[model samples]
Target: MTDTNRTCFMKGQGAQPRRDRSQLPPRKMATLIIVLTMLFFLAAAHNAAAQPQKPQPERPLVFVPGILGSRLVDDNGTVIWGDRNSYLNFPKLEIAPSGPVTALHSDGRLVESINVLGPFWTIHQYDTLLHYLHSLGYIDNETLFVFAYDWRLSNFETAKQLQTFVDDPKRGRLQNGQFDLLSHSMGGIVSKLWMVKEGGAARVHKAIYMGTPFQGSMNAFETLSDGWGDFTNFIAGGLPTVRRVALSFPALYELLPTYDKCCRLGSPEKYTPLDVLDVATWRQRDWLPSEYRANGPRGAAFERGLSEARRVGELMRQPIPGVAQVMIAGDYFDTGLYLYVPTNRQSWRDWNFRRSKGDGTVPVWSAANNFSSIEGTEPSFQQHATIFADKYLQNKLERELLNTAPPPVKHDVLGEIDTPKHEKRRLDLARADLSPRIAEPGANATVTVAFEFETGVTRGDVQPTAQLLQRGAADAPITLVETTTDADLAVRRLTFAGSLVAPAVEDTYRIDINVAGQGDHAVFLTVLSAGRRQP
Candidate 1:
């Protein structure tokens, strides 16, 4: 054996390849083994890193209720239950980031029913909505943070408290998307104050205002006994408390910095009363340029309110901002209706001031941010959705009204107005009526009618109907297909077939069509013709 092999032989053990280093020093070998082990581990880790990581789930949603309103109900009719001091309690919506959060925020304690109820006529009715949404499986694994503040307090004070909650140092570490806010009436104002003035906007993703009094309500001033206006001297002229309130449009306009030419004087009636309560009343009020803008001391109050509103708005203005705003408005139900009178003081009392589909306080125009002078009919169909307590729908409607919805408005922003955009929007054509304009010259011709159905929330098979109205001639007669059966919707392709009399030529040949919703849906209609058209 060679010298190396001889050393191995002398040890009485066959020598392994020196390249293998089986006979290496213990510490060196151990160190080499350790290095190889680490290398293996590092390689394994790198390979593992090459694979894709699992996707994280969506963050939970947050629900912020409007004002100090509670979502509870009690036998006593108090919307909020009171503690020993008659203090109020509220409910909240709690959705876990990974599970369902079904708690509603209350101004006070949310557990007891004794302090709930009585605030609004629709308290319990509204709570039923929460139960319904829960049944729909919307509250799962979501963290719903319900915030409550004393809205009865000044807006500045309430806003500060909300700001602190959003700015809490621990808040930054929490993993979640922005909260979705749903507010109503005074709650809307409170939210605006918080989001804009208090920097809550940074944390909010969306806000929905329902029947908020962005502009002062005439009803507020009207509620004062007729003599209350006479006390302008007492409490420093109309009570500084009342004068400084930003509830009404006249008051709010004073807070905003940007008042249009109409607001330059004081009264908003000059350009348009779109933001004010009872917009129709302006039609009857004699208006002039001088009455439009603020001028004197009374105007000073107007300037104050306008400035505040503007300041609140300024906080919201940002490039690619985080928050979305929406407003939902209701038209007064009895606007044009007549009322009966009981006595002189009640001279034809028209409580018709209340909105038909609204919360009895907010008028459609005033509730919506119509002050932008955007020329279009506001959507009047939101009442249908509000009947259900889906805060999402409410939020959408409110945002659309405020023109603060996401890039594209999903809510029914156009009530009955026929704008170009509205015209282009696809209608769920549920039914159609195809009728011949003229009996024809006995030439082979036909009219075809087709019907279909569609829905925004559901994707399923749909069926519709087609109805026909035939007017033989002006002096001849008119016949409407009066049938209560679904068969009345059958498609008709009228052609000059056997024994089919050609349409008679007379002074006028026409067909009228009327489409109605069927089943559990409202259907839109579209008609097309293959024969001579009628004017």
Candidate 2:
């Protein structure tokens, strides 16, 4: 048995006849079993080592979205602040007069791009940012984290919530106990609060702000004082309830421009400076949304809000040098710079806001953290709501985040005009009119849009894309039915026709008649999706 075992086990691969275990002695069988067992364990260990391991992030990332970016859900996980019907019942989101922020119940928060009008018309909030993060090897719930809070509440409360979120071992806290931040718009304020106030700067390695209203924008006053430029009118159908609900959000008040002498108390030419942070100033001007009149907020209700805004504004003024930060601003369109208060407490609709180069929402000065210089100018012909979706900026951001950027390029920026006009994006926007502006839901309908542009603006350069807006990969755009252009006249006339099945979500459907290199001219069509026809 010993000779057979020794001969058969010789290393060089020659076949040997199989031998029965029973024929071998007990000691030999035990030795064979041990050898085989060892081989088995070695193979198992090798295979286990070969399996791929999940990659860990160097500095884990925490994505913070702006106001209206995070989806608010009730206790039952029913989404309240997303989708088409979200603003239809705007009163449901309102805070009570002199009531605690806890009056409204938005217990659950989801970090996702909002489905703005419907599944097809998604506002590309942070989905693209998230996708880029994932492509860079950020793992979900491990290396990558999302901080979603109810933006309607004061940033003070939201900052406290952010503190709680980061400290949780399963979320913002990683192996290294450090994370990077990507905050957009109001999210930047929330991040700053957590960093400066809540001692979060120690844990944050870096932060990137996109189109943030650091100094603030005059649009906030426009929203509350009068629905002058309020886009909510399109959603809520010019309801006073929209303003009432917006007034309830203390956080919105914080967005009111603290710089640029927020409002002139008297006439446009000669006026006294108004303390925008003062609730009394709001009251004296009779500019509150309480009664839907020009009267300011009920003194008691908005004092706390104004206080919150003042505290936040002070915090924003202070610099936090410990944490590294990068700020990106959009300088394409004209944005609200200052408010002009007319005599007799005139309605804000008449000569509302003086404008300057901004991103349609935030002025360039505000977006760059109040830095008014050439280097701080990251000029892009982009709008405030869509800044994050820019591919060129995204590339720059990737390099900046990774510390792989080349020398910064110098731009010969022309200084903002001294007396800027209260003009919207100074682009030759095509005026679009939808023919037979109504369609039945779920049925294929012929949709044609006629666009009129200034004659001097080059033609064929403006290829009008007609479709419902959404993330690139989510859905196919509407099929083009026809495209035509007329000979140059005083106004260049271009036409684009497309085919689409009417969405049953809402009666009002807008086709984004966006001319390339031109501004948005949305054409709304009435659909009997809700069985209530628009008269």
By TM-score, who's the top model here? 2
lDDT of 2: 0.65
Question: Where does candidate 2 have its weakest 10-residue lDDT segment?
Answer: 411-420
Residue 309, candidate 1: C-alpha displacement in angstroms: 8.1
lDDT per residue as tens, model 1, 1-535: 6997787786677545345545788888899999999999999999999986532212223333433343332334444323321221211111222221233233432222222112211112235444543443344334334455443333555567666655555555223445556665555666777766556676666676655655433334233212123222131123333333222223233222121221121222332212322222222332112222344224443344445655544433322257666555544121111111122223112222211223233434445545454233233332322322333343333333332233343433222212233332222222222333223444332323222222121111122222222233232222222222244223211111111223433222222222221111111111223232232
Model 2, 1-535: lDDT tens per residue? 5976767676335766556756888898899999999999999999988986443345778888888777666556666676566655455567765563333454435445444344333444566677887876777787777888788888889999988887776662544666788888898999999899998898888888888888888878666655532344555646466676787887898898887576776766888777878756655554555553334445455777788788888889788877878887876555778787776655544536777667778877788876446265455545677677655566556565553344344332222211123222223222345545555677666656544432343334334566764323343366554365445434554456777776655445556654443334344555554444342
lDDT of each: 0.36, 0.65
Best candidate, lDDT-wise?
2
Q: What TM-score number comes out for model 1?
A: 0.38
TM-score per candidate, chains pooled: 0.38, 0.68
Task: TM-score for candidate 2, please give it.
Answer: 0.68
